[model samples]
Target: MAKKRNQVRRCVKKYIPYELHPDDFLQTMTKIFCYSRWFGVAGSGNLVWKIFGILILLLLAIIEGVAIWRVIKALAGWAVDIIGHRSVTARLAGTMFYASSIVTLILSWKLSSSWDELAAFWASVDQTMAINVPPDKNLKNRMISVTFIIMACVILEHTMCMMSQIGFDCPASLILKRYTLMSHGFLLLRTDYSIWFAIPLLFLSKVATILWNYQDTLIVTVSMGLTSRYYRLNNFVAKFSVAVKKDLSRNKQSNSLNSRNEYTWRKIREAYVKQAMLVRRVDAWLGGLILLSSLVNFYFICLQLFLGITQGLSGSFIKRLYYLVSLVWLCVRVSCVVLAAADINVQSKRALRYLYACDAHCYNIEVERLQNQLSKEYIALTGMGFFSLNRSILLKVRKDMAGAVITYELVLIQFDDNGTTAHIPSQSNATF
Candidate 1:
């Protein structure tokens, strides 16, 4: 087991880059977006590629819009049929799935528009790290590892969903089914449109799906990056505190040492301020996307659970497996986003304990300022100025989702029972 673990670690280290600067944290994602033509205006591409990217973005917008309309139309038709609980739940799930595509498009557009500002923000962060934080290989490896893990999860989930929709079959129908599934039923809605159109539509659908998953991954990546800086800052303070204590105990403290410690404390305070400002800028840019992601994740989680409870036993084995995997994956992804953002808050306050641990001789005005700044200011990502993302919110969301699923299950049971009795005639009406 130990040997296997070591081999696995080596493989991971070999694949993931060793020297990842903070500014290049999103390089992989940028390449993906550029290739998919989802990020044209702000992407690093030639003039022709940029124009082609714009066209691709426009096409995606149209496709997603049409898909949303088709879903609404399908939902209306389903309501008319009024089959059962299963139909309603299935339709609702599909609606949310397609609706998410539009949301992803909006996020992608916003990111593209704000690319210049974001680039500047990253540059500023890299500059700060260069000046204050010493290079640490372990930190770089950890950040890249986190990013790779999240990306892997998303890609795996997408592949599974696609496979579930289009299982191994004959080559002729396989192409048809692949495009049909990607269309989200748009192709079916308008039979007059040639099947050939499904080719481009299918490609656009794949890109939209990438954007949908990438939004959350980006948030987690940026949060982890910010958290790393805070971790480094806290580590520095911890070491300084230890040094101060040792010097005092040995009765070797001197004016020169005191002066140096004071200067270090000042630099630490300045770095904190800069990081805090960067966090705010990031929040301003990503707050809307975060808000949308949280709400979308919450809705789908509940929807998936409701479907599982309603159809788990009656559904086919493959369907049960799909729902099980989807629910678990959704939960894991949301947790990554929430916990990663919350960690920023956790690491920021951690320095306070070390600051308080400093000896009297080592303590200075700068230390007090940092303490006040950290203690008094609440630093964490928020949902478009509405709610903050933290541990408390995560717990509350879990509790609420549980309550919601239970309530929905009970209501469904009652609904079905009443529906069954409504068809039966009274005995008086059946007299012979």
Candidate 2:
């Protein structure tokens, strides 16, 4: 008993140093297992790993199901047409969205199955722990390398697709592009975060599978490779950004700051200033909704990272909330694109109240003819261009602007009529 206790003490001393916090050992032993938190996911030693593997399968299935459901819901809606009214762009966007969703679902299913199989294999290996075993270092190394290569290639391909679809050349395009890229990037980042968590869990599971697997060398190598890849990618992105910034700075430096800058720059600056003010208004109105989402995502990322290291499952609620927020945003953006497309034939009517008898008669005749010809002419002018997916997205933005305008108008009306309370639209519910 004394020797056994000494061995345990030595083992704890040897193993516990890798923990970020000294208390992580205690936390790991006592804190709820994430798998166990979901009933039936934990069982006897072998079965636990098996069940854990199955849980992973279930998770992937759920994600795929949710993705499919979202795509189907996106397709089933009149919102797409009604909101993007008369837009060919909106229709194209609808098609693109459906295609993207299908592709993602398929990719996710394939990846999930691979992961499940790996987990099951490890679980099976663990079930026979009493038998003599060999290291099989070459096989293990190859497996790890293949797993990483597959993940890296898939991730790179997805990132390139995102860059092609969403990345733009200029500042104006960057606004929409940035959001699109970030949204998709966030999805990838979220997946990576899951991978980070799973790695440690798989390491522990492997330990339970065999004494040889408990050797830290393999885990360290795998982790180092992944970390190196991530760091290299991040550095590359940073350098690209630096290059762009340098070019912009050089361009600005080349131009005279005072003379041409004032004339050309002032006019352009004024236009942008006005636009900035309008954008600020929109952003201000959206602050509560989007800010909440950003905050939740921030929390999830931090908490998940912490949990991944500590073998704890804190902040899952926040993660789910973040996902829910993402879902909502996705729906809103899609709906907006559709609405904008459907609005292609929309126009304004004006009433002129001027006294000129002959001019009035000519105007009346021309106006009548114009009104009669308006639909065909307007339809021809807008065509599929107005129906374009981007335009549909723009129209959704216009709807938001319209709502803001309506809110301001209502406030003014209330102020004028009552000299009391002024109304503002609830920012929480406002959508673009």
Candidate 3:
């Protein structure tokens, strides 16, 4: 089984996109979107010259579109590698990750098609039964419409991009390196990677849970979504290790006793500070998104609980059960991510243990200074830097979960006593 796994891994590796020049795509976007391409005449020319420039720019835009397709194809290959289908579970996971998204887009589409029926139902239902209805009956329709429209645009554009990259024959490292360059080494505050990498993961996790099912789909999707966060952290650590090793080697070669080289030691010290700051920047980049997911998950868990209670209080026995099961499953799904995220934080801090345990004989003045800079002893992954994601969060969540359940139970009891459980009257009359 191990041999087979390795064989599959090898085969998969053989197919990854090679020789990625992501800058080309960036440049293409710049050209297409930049207004300078259409106006701002440099060389003296007649009115015909302006028209000629416009025509030429349009031609280039068409040509760049073709190249953009290739970039997309290359990216598709990269995404495939990231999905990592070397085992049965992995294959199923990749399939479900994508299939679920497709299914959600479809479900939204189907709901959109039945808008007329929904409209009629809303019209027939009086304001008394409209407890959940928006002030505008069309609000739900608009939300679904807008959501799917955006989804369609993204999906279409990405599809073209992916199709263009299929068998694109680009080197993955080159693509990433160029992406790093284009992104100014991730310091430019650009959001290309976040859009291309993070957004899809976010969308996938949400969509997978869109239409609840009693199966492993939720587990698979949450895991896949968190993979991006894990990958980013792992990538940073790898890069950080390489950086530290290089710094250590340089420190070891330096003469600590030489007063003349004191400035060099200062520069090395500065580099250590920069690296530490960069680690925080890495956190800032994706930390908010992960935190957002955590918050959303927590919100929904409470929501599911409240929904279960309210439905039960209102005599929706089956709905209450449905939500009860949903609440449990949602908690389970969230626990998986919280625990995984907590583990990530723990491992991230543990990366420093090796340095702490390193032989002190190898230390120089600069190295010692660098060590002091990192002397906090541990740095864990955080959610928006607001709080650390560790076993502590799990405990806090447990506490909060109990509070939320209690709060909802109290509210449900109050509503039941007040006879507000039937908050909305059922609509049986038809006027629409």
Candidate 4:
């Protein structure tokens, strides 16, 4: 039996490309997502696992719903007290945080629902590129490294935020109390909640945090994978261009060789088409996620900057440290997500450079077709058809954020100059 098994393994290895195996491609990410219950493994026939995944998702949904409800209730209370309280910043930040959490949870549910289509997309991408482009030798290591970095950053940020809230000077009992309240999303509720309730909410909050960070990590990882494929394709074209130049210079070009070059170009073109289609599929799957992530990141960044400028070294040491670390971390993470997605568009267009440089002898109908396809197609991820993710977006977002911060600062300065505070009007104060 062992001999027969070995023989079968050898036969399969000999005939099938390693990249064709869906399990091997993005294996680390697949494992992480599956373990988190955000996605199920493709082709799995385990009934119990599927049921368990469903239950886990349902539980998370219920928890998130409760958390959101609590946030809304807190917002209503704040609205009533807005005239007397100057805690606008805290309220806004908390609201944005919970709103972003809700968005991340929804994206997670979407991913779980579309796992089969996602699996098929991966399979198609692998089959398209496996024939000519060799797999990246360090892909697994790279993925693992990315996962590690994302996890470390998230864990550090969460810990620091929690500690900042609890304060370093507090006694153990007080610290524990504060931690429970914060984790249970009851800090803003201003009411005592049961320990039993807090414990479960704490666990659910941790899970929610994981899902939030994992969503961005997943986007970055998948973007890296797609960008690498396009890069490989571009490299192949470059090398082939070099060979074509050499043949033309040596006067060794012949009819058969020209035909072969054309055939290669045709194959590359077909692969390019497949890649573009795969990107569209990916965009469809992740567009809502990207849109929500961008909005949430933008809002928080603006809010953080506003708070940092207005507060400015006035808070506790731990609070100051948390603010600085979180701002830097958020900027780095957001930049990574944006640039990673943008590179897909950049890499897709890069092939055009090589195609244009092809030797005259090698240029043919296939070459022209490929050039046209590359030039005409605006292949990039989008925010649910609202906006394209590209280099320009980064610049635009930065500009807008700066403008927003400046405008907010001006408003505060005007309020201070008038010697009166800006406050939300109470119901009794309404004129109409």
lDDT of 1 by residue, 278-340 (tens): 888888888987998888777666655655565553434553455566667778888878999
Which sequence of candidate numbers ranks them by lDDT, best first?
4, 1, 3, 2
Error of 4 at 247 (Å): 2.8
lDDT of each residue in 184-237, candidate 2, tens digit only: 221222224344433433332222212111111122222232222223222332
Q: Which regions in candidate 4 have their CA more than 4 angstroms from the true location?
A: 1-23, 38-89, 128-131, 182-191, 251-253, 406-432
Give lDDT per model, in order. 0.61, 0.30, 0.37, 0.65
lDDT of 3 by residue, 1-432 (tens): 676545544433322224321222123212222322123121223466456544543433432343244234333453222111121222222233333323333333233333344334323322212111112233234333433443453344333323222223547644533332221211112233454543333332233333222112222222222332333333433443454456456675533323222333344345334333433543543454455456545644554454445444332344333333445545665565566555544544443454454445433475456556555544455667788766788888878787886775675444233312110000000000
Model 3: colliding residue pairs: 18-170, 18-171, 19-170, 19-171, 20-175, 72-161, 73-165, 74-165
CA lDDT of 143 in candidate 2?
Answer: 40
Cα lDDT for residue 76, model 4?
A: 57
Give per-candidate clash totals: 0, 24, 8, 0
Error of 1 at 73 (Å): 4.4
Best by TM-score: 4
Candidate 3: regions farther than 4 A off: 1-292, 306-325, 377-385, 416-432
Quote the positional error of residue 195 for candidate 1 in Å. 2.2
**TM, every model:** 0.77, 0.20, 0.35, 0.80
Cα deviation of 299 in candidate 1 (Å)? 1.1
